[model samples]
Target: MLGLSADNHHPLMLQRVTLGLVSLVAAFLTVTTFFRVELLHHLLWSNGPENNSSCPYGHFRLVGMKDCLSWLSCEMMQSEVTVMKLIGQGAVKQVFLAHWKGNKVALSRLAVSEFSNDFFHGLEMLKGLQSVYVVKLLGYCEDHTILTEYHRFGSLTNINSILEQEDHRSFNTWEVRFRLAIEYAMFLHFLHNSPLGPRVMCDSNDLGKTLSQYLLTADLHVVANDLDALPLVNRSAGLLVKCGARQLQGDFVSPEQLWPFGDDLPFSDDLMPPYDEKTDIWKIPDVTDFLLGQVEGSDVLRLHLFQLHRDCKRNLPQQRPSALRVVQTYKAVYTLLTQESELSGTYSGTSRDL
Candidate 1:
């Protein structure tokens, strides 16, 4: 009537309202898709890009995403890491599935706000780790964290995904896990021996140290920022851990090969503690916590690793055990025992015949 067809007026208003609603939904989803730094109870889930189903990284906090994102600026994106699919978020980043040549790999992108002290410290330790158990190094960009290696399945953080996996290649079999733990133990021992072993060791006690970029996690990996809601992510980890079905004893250890001579020294972080290899001790037991499901007892096997972890955690760093000594104890344990089937009680006390 007002110089416009009745049909035109209805559709126009509806179209405007619909467009506004769509925009709001899109915006909500986009924000929810990234890492949140808030606590689990507080961070409410709204909407976002759909979560990755088969993405190989373990339990990831949702980070932002872009479809077929371009890498025109990053030299590696074009040449080395070919971004094929998006993974999920990390403690400080988002991840992606990329190919280095023909090799399949998972990449992590860190959140800007999550760049706190602990995150960097872990990153520093990760950088110096030239060991195999950790994620492999790769190139990155301003908006992503690139990592490479065989994308086998997932991580300890997301073990259930690998467990429910029906392919003959479930990565969470008790045996494979045994090996993964043992091998990483070797990695820890190597860290103990190397200059990169202790964080302080890498830099002399002399405060004039110029931090090495190679020693920095940020240098090794790039990330997609937005880490304002951390509590949400931490609860996510706890949930993931809770979901795991097959529980390994919290102190189940691998073979003795992981222990080394350098592991026996003491490396303390107590401001003015001496330079030594003791830090390795604390790592082993906590690592044991990761490997074995927690329970308690004196199965000589566990007590050993338990003591190692305890020794390292000691307030008086000098009292700690060495990675070197730890391995030696394993050797001694093996020497006294015969095989996996041999024993009710372990040690020189009384040989409970198998």
Candidate 2:
């Protein structure tokens, strides 16, 4: 055997050690790459915007994959949708004035317990809607908080309070009240004629009893703030439209709308008569009444409105006017109100000017 020189042996040993280190590092990277890819795939499957492909209008398509991940990840919610203030609270949800992506928004932060499949289903139902009179839902967080377009002027209830106070004057004119009535009628008409079908039931609590449910924008336009709370009728199944666990209440609720199911029974069953679009007709009169109480108009206008109210209040469901017909009648009434306003020089400028 030949004896190797010491210098030559050192070089050989160093080469072997370097090769071993490189091989170990390569194997470790391979394992980590496999897990990273798997984690990304799992996240895409569970929370990506691509899951909303069935959304008819492509509401989620505009958001990129990075933004979609941001929408889904709970870690980023605090950074993205920042709550500015608490605006209002309902029986089921709390409304917050929030800033999302540099735009002012309303965040409806629901109880974590209430963030079940029902809230998600409600989001699915509302995703397809595109209308001026309806509040636009921006996105949702994992914690059951929904972001919507914030109305600058607050709600119709706020307007009512301002009207009641003689000092706070902005929307107190008869023309503004008349215009509000007409616009509210048009809002209902739009909902009743939705592509999702006319069986959609606006929340009973929001419609008649509390004016706060209708939000007033800076433009003086009225938007239905509780659209997410609406109960969508199964258009395919012709099922009874339900307002979730909360039932219709007050003097405006129709007799057919009542059925005690107790706690155990499911509400989608046949125990109650199928609630039709006409259910909304019963509530439209409430808007007219609220408007009339706020303004002193001509006897002719009041009488015509009284007749319209009676028509809407008919006991028989079939006897009530359709939302479309109500819209037409209100338009005619609006024209008369406009002419009177012009004559009396009480025409507060168009909603834009106001």
Whole-model Cα lDDT per candidate?
0.38, 0.62
Candidate whose lDDT is highest: 2
Clashes of each: 40, 0
Question: Candidate 1: misplaced stretches above 4 Å?
Answer: 1-76, 113-134, 140-145, 159-178, 195-197, 200-280, 294-300, 303-313, 330-354
User: For residues 1-354, could you state the per-residue lDDT of candidate 1 as single tens digits?
Assistant: 457788888999999999999999989754643322212111111121122222332222223333322222456565667667766554455567777656666665565664654344444444444232234434344444445343333434333343345642333333233223343344345445554423222211111111111111111111112112111112223321110122112222111112222435432222221223343344455544544332122244465455555665665546766555654444333333323323544222211110
Angstrom error at residue 305, model 1: 4.6
- Each candidate's TM vs. the true structure? 0.42, 0.68
Highest TM-score, which number?
2
Give lDDT tens digits, candidate 2, residues 120-150: 6555555655455566656666667676667
How far residue 249's Cα lies from its native spot in candidate 2, in Å, is: 5.1
Give the TM-score comparing model 1 with the true structure, all chains together. 0.42
